[model samples]
Target: MSESLLHRCPVVPVVVIHDAAHALPLGEALLAGGITVAEITLRTAAGIGAIEALATALPELHVGAGSVLVAEHVDQVVDAGARFVVSPGLSVAVLARAQARGVAALPGVATSSELMTAVGLGVTEVKFFPAGLLGGPAAIRALAAPFTSMTFMPSGGVSADNMADYLAIPAVPAVSGSWMVDPGLLAEGRWDEVTARSAAAIRAARGSGAFQRVV
Candidate 1:
């Protein structure tokens, strides 16, 4: 897991694995499809094991722990070989824990105050969570005016359809979603479907035209 991996691609697959057994294969499929970063959310009991398995199996791919809301969750992910951590909301305690552990943390910020707090805490890159419900690209554009130095990884409701919209905003560093890694397909053991979707998402993001300007 490399800190720079998230920036290498515009989209990071937000994954939720219920079966730890499928972790390695699923990660390989995503990586084979040109998607290098995977965010395994701790939304299920299998998430930690899945992260561990994927990290061990796909040494070249970047694996991040997401939905980390507590300080302890940070420790758990760090111990499980997570290269970075992401939270749905900014928490001073959570950020402090990640900083102390020397792990890259992308805390979520939905408002100016939250963004300011993250900036004050030395966080330049954050997750614009629930992006669609929060006004999507327009909202992020407005926030970027005062915080020109800040960057974001907008997640939640982010898909191929609106990835271009988010990438057009200078403030957004990247975007993430589970659209590439469909849970239904995973549950049905459809690795081929997952790989195809992942490939399509990677191509769609690359073809969006906004990445050229940013790069």
Candidate 2:
């Protein structure tokens, strides 16, 4: 499940929806732009509802929960039809609960110790949060040196300008960020702009040789 989800798109848009009504259109816009996966964040009250709306109404758009912080949150998102769960940091309870519930968990790892913990938990994929602050793709390359079996998805600080850099690393199967689904664009209901950005991102990913690198 983790491999399938990661390979669906080289750029996973990290979305934060303030209104559930906008969920359907957003999903359609992404699909129109050639993106297949979205990480709807639990950063707002409408997040869970948005997840459910998209998951149920547009099953083709692989929906997942982001900014998930606890075991309970995992239950909430999985129940809402999230195919996967992402957190800002690794948590034993979160990973355990996700495994128990049969949902893929992509917990964040910013250090070698965290990566070790995730490995012990049987996690094969992880999100590298605040990628820029943590040294971006170079940091991921260094961190992945010993964990050759693990793949990474760089999240925070990821943007079109630097997404290619992240995808250039063989260990990075995908990159996640909110640039394609920026709050301002959503607030203004600029679905066209969203589609354009999403399409451009996909084009960039392909140009970066993401498909050739993904195993």
lDDT of each: 0.84, 0.90
TM-score for all models, in order of appearance: 0.94, 0.96
* Cα displacement (Å) at residue 153, model 2: 0.4
Clashes of 2: 0
CA deviation > 4 Å runs, candidate 1: 1-5, 210-215
Judged by whole-model lDDT over C-alpha atoms, candidate 1 comes out at 0.84
**Candidate 1 residue pairs that clash:** none
Give the alpha carbon lDDT tens digit for every residue of 1-215 in model 1: 12443466677889988999989989888887878888999999999999899888898888889999999999999999998899999999998898888888888889999988987887788888899999988889899999987888888889878887887776675789988787888899888888898888767766766456435
Best by lDDT: 2
Flag clash pairs in model 2.
none
Model 1 scores a TM of 0.94
